[model samples]
Target: MQKKQFKEVVVEVKHVSKHYKIFGREDTVKALNDIHLANDAELQPVRRGEFVMLRGPSGGGKTSLLNLLGTIDRATEGVIELFSSPITPESSDEYLAKLRLEKIGFVFQTFNLLATMSAYENVELPMIILGKLKPEQRKKRAIELLTLVGLQDRLDHLPSELSGGEQQRVTIARALANEPEILLLDEPTGDLDTKNTVEVMDLLLDLNLKLKTTCIMVTHNPDIECYADRILYLADGVFEKQAINIEQTRLDYDKYIEYLNAQTHGTH
Candidate 1:
């Protein structure tokens, strides 16, 4: 991978607010309220492979924040600057859409794969839609990505044929196909089993270190946050606190699962 332009500010979110207008409801819900975060606060520039975790409960603005950073959703008020470019624009929807497709990579909770297509074909769909490469080259690159995700043998398998873990892996491969500078994942392991969750998280960490891809992930799982270099806690649409630990957080994947399950069932 080519070296990224280290910015004094990779992402500068200045007093941003996002509100969703419901069609039937009288009250609009505020997803993000007066959120301010400087990517390079405290004399720290954004380096490649800088991992950040946005931690919050389900109702909080974690997903909304990720959407803002991804440039897929706009804030109702305030400025969002990415790579020194104003993402929260006053005009032009065309520009924002263009930026999202070319600059950012997204891994969603649903996996978002075409059920009819094979794993390799699903991965190449984005390149085809973007017209980024020729058919032959796209095919080759898709195979290469699948191999990287340990899905070399399952490339020709359909989504229905593959396990849920394999499907998510294909989604990950697709996300990397664009070779984006920043990867935004929302609850990537939310649907996976314990073993698969760990495997997926491990793969993401490996990619972060090896490819130097800047990663921003949102999750309630503390174990998942362990992979991050910095953790930002959110509550009631606000940044509550932040923790910076250069070392990985002590993560016992099984223990976390047990705790979560116990909470779910209220078992002793």
Candidate 2:
């Protein structure tokens, strides 16, 4: 085995746990139970420009962990360090909001593009909220992002007019509008057909490499694990195991589709 290179750590989870309270019940649903990430030598910490994937069974707290890491939800116990700054349940919402706006970006299974907004407008919205760029600057960045995502020609098209893959590309462009250091993706390809899935993952891998953005993604597809530098498996709300890839890889669309077809046919 090759000695894996390590980089500066950008995100750390220390003994983090999460649970949700039922509005009218005494019983609370435990989502994560005292999990550690990027904390041990065996489980290497997620570093700058590292692509990590969280995989586990349904209801195993994969999305919950992603949410906590993204600062969209608070951990019930322990703290998560983002860019070396600690975030606890007591962290101020205002501060977290600012951090998210300036440092973190998110893409989800649902594209979440506004129905009435064009691709350019969707991509521009984040910069508008951040308010760091002038109107013209935002316009230029929006176009650049859309072009980067291969949607330059679809800039004026509404979400409804775009295909599943195109809608996902728009979402990815929108997520990058603020030039965030970390991009959190929860099943960004979950809604796509196999062809689109291959296309979208390839695009994400390209962007991750090009922008040097740390990517933490939650995915159910094990076949695509090669895209990640490290894969963390969560089961019953704990880190079940971890796997590190010496190098990132992509799925060739034609070969992947052929393999899927073989699997389907072989089952008969």
Candidate 3:
């Protein structure tokens, strides 16, 4: 079997550290301590179209690393670059926001959908903020993405009316609204049941394969790591190990659909 080859470095972190000072305390907490993603001898870049998983115990700075990679937060020390461009602490907020809007997508554990907005509207919100597409274009694209995530029937449903899995799917559709090159997910399956988690993971895998989108996800579930090309384990705000998943399996959409159909028929 041939090994999958990755092209172009998407993210690079070098000796990064993040620190926070506690209010009313004399001590400073080190959220991340001297994290080096790519060393000199081994340049392990997160390449385009790769699924990289960050796994660690709570308070290990996994979310913090994801936040830095997504450009949501700046590292207190060291350097981070996206697509070879350095994302320094001095980078303007406007620039970072624009970069995030244009090149990056984010999915949160909370499913962060607006309660008042219908699924379609929730998906359309990103494009509206982007202001690049016309009303018809946005609507058409929103429908396409919602359909892609198997939520076409739930287009008009509000978040409250949808199940946790359905709401998370809506969020995924919204994240893809601008067709970002990189997708950042923070514990996407944290709130989902086993079946829903599998479904969501399948959808993500399909998207990553079909769209060639680079994905960086923070996960606590070891089962989720099976789909990742590489897993970075962190502890106490530092990387402890990096493991390449030789047995990583790609979920075939056709087979997945067939399984879903069989389950539906069996239920009825």
* Highest TM-score against the true fold, candidate: 2
Off by over 4 Å in 2: 1-5, 39-41
List, residue by residue over 1-268, the lDDT tens digit for candidate 2. Answer: 2334557889988888998998999999999998877557467668898889999999999999999989999999988999999997678999999999999999999999999999999999999999999999999999999999999999999999999999999999999999999999999999999888988998888887878888999999999999998899999898899898888999988888788888989952
The TM-score, computed over Cα atoms with residue i paired to residue i, of candidate 3 is 0.91
What TM-score, over all chains together, does every model reach? Answer: 0.87, 0.95, 0.91
The per-model lDDT (C-alpha) reads: 0.82, 0.91, 0.89
Per-residue accuracy of model 1 over 180-248 as CA lDDT, tens digit each: 878999999889988888888888987887887888899877767778888888888988888886565
lDDT of 3 by residue, 146-256 (tens): 999998899999999999999999999999999998999999999997778888998898888789889999999886677888999989999888889875575555665
What is the alpha-carbon lDDT of model 2 when measured against the actual structure? 0.91
Q: Candidate order by TM-score, highest to lowest?
A: 2, 3, 1
Instruction: Estimate candidate 3's alpha-carbon lDDT, on a 0 to 1 scale.
Output: 0.89
Candidate 2 TM-score over all chains jointly: 0.95
Which of candidates 1 and 2 reaches a greater lDDT? 2
**What is the TM-score of candidate 1?**
0.87
Off by over 4 Å in 3: 1-3, 39-43, 250-268
lDDT-sorted candidate list, best first = 2, 3, 1
User: What C-alpha lDDT, on a 0 to 100 scale, does residue 233 get in candidate 1?
Assistant: 85
Comparison by TM-score, 2 against 3, better one:
2
